[model samples]
Target: MNKLFLVPLMLLPSLAFAFPIDVTKKLNGAEIVYNTTTISSNMAAINIQNVGGTAAQCRVVFVNGPENPRVRNTVVQSGSSSYVTANFNRAVIRLRITLTCNPT
Candidate 1:
């Protein structure tokens, strides 16, 4: 009986999911830099850096499949950095992000 159950488990294929991330930026010459990092299966973060001479106001949107989009806004001073994060109720198989910025 134990051998029969073990034999069926050995025939099962590996269950793996590659959670890829895609980012689209609409920054219009604001001298801003950003990157998306996956913190876990249900959480993510965005790091924004400003390397310009003026402050930048940025809007970051995080999208997970079958969930409402998460929006975050922040202002980064010149030569400074900030981070915006999102926590989802469901596991994130893939992440989509839109980053928009303007010089303030």
Candidate 2:
């Protein structure tokens, strides 16, 4: 029935916006790129790429409500990419990520 189909269609938009992700980056003259992805309700990952001629050292911090902030560090080689992940103890309704990078 058309009414049944409409019910699912309306939910499609809600599912797409179930969670929101915010990213703040501080790249000091380094050609760095980052992308975020949601793995699950309590997990997320960030993909970092270095496109400059020099290597880069990056620190990533993930914060969720009422949970200890998760921190990760990685060195990305020129023309390469790396991933940083965080798993929280509670459902992540909102996620905040901070990325800081410097040329090495």
Candidate 3:
């Protein structure tokens, strides 16, 4: 019926606005950095950096938002690099970060 169709149509915008882009990177012996200039409604971008001489690994987990949380990982090889530019919703989010470094 028309009412049924209308229900789905109304949800389209909200559904479309829920998901964000995933990003990843790798770096070493310095800081890995990411930046964003713009974000839409319920949307945000995440930046990651590594600042050390040894290879490093990191992960980011989002706890709250319009959509479910997600995890992103990066591995920086020795004297190399890794990084990520992630997109997410701005819904009372929490981040769980982990880092590991290899012995030089």
Q: Pick the candidate with the highest lDDT.
A: 2
User: Model 2: residues >4 Å from true position, as ranges?
Assistant: 1-18
Task: State in Å the error of residue 3, model 1.
Answer: 22
Clash count, one per candidate: 0, 0, 10
Ranking by lDDT: 2, 1, 3
lDDT of each: 0.88, 0.92, 0.47
Lowest lDDT sum, 10 consecutive residues, model 1, at 10-19
Provide TM-scores for the models: 0.81, 0.85, 0.39
- Strongest candidate by TM-score: 2
Residue 101, model 1: Cα distance from true site in angstroms:
0.2
Query: In candidate 3, what are the lDDT values of residues 1-104, reduced to their tens digit?
Result: 89988998898866554343433333333355544322444444455444555555665554343556556666765555445434444542333332333333
Residue 102 lDDT (model 2): 96
Scored by lDDT, model 2 comes in at: 0.92
Least well predicted 10-residue stretch by lDDT in candidate 2: 11-20
Task: Itemize residue pairs with steric clashes in candidate 2.
Answer: none
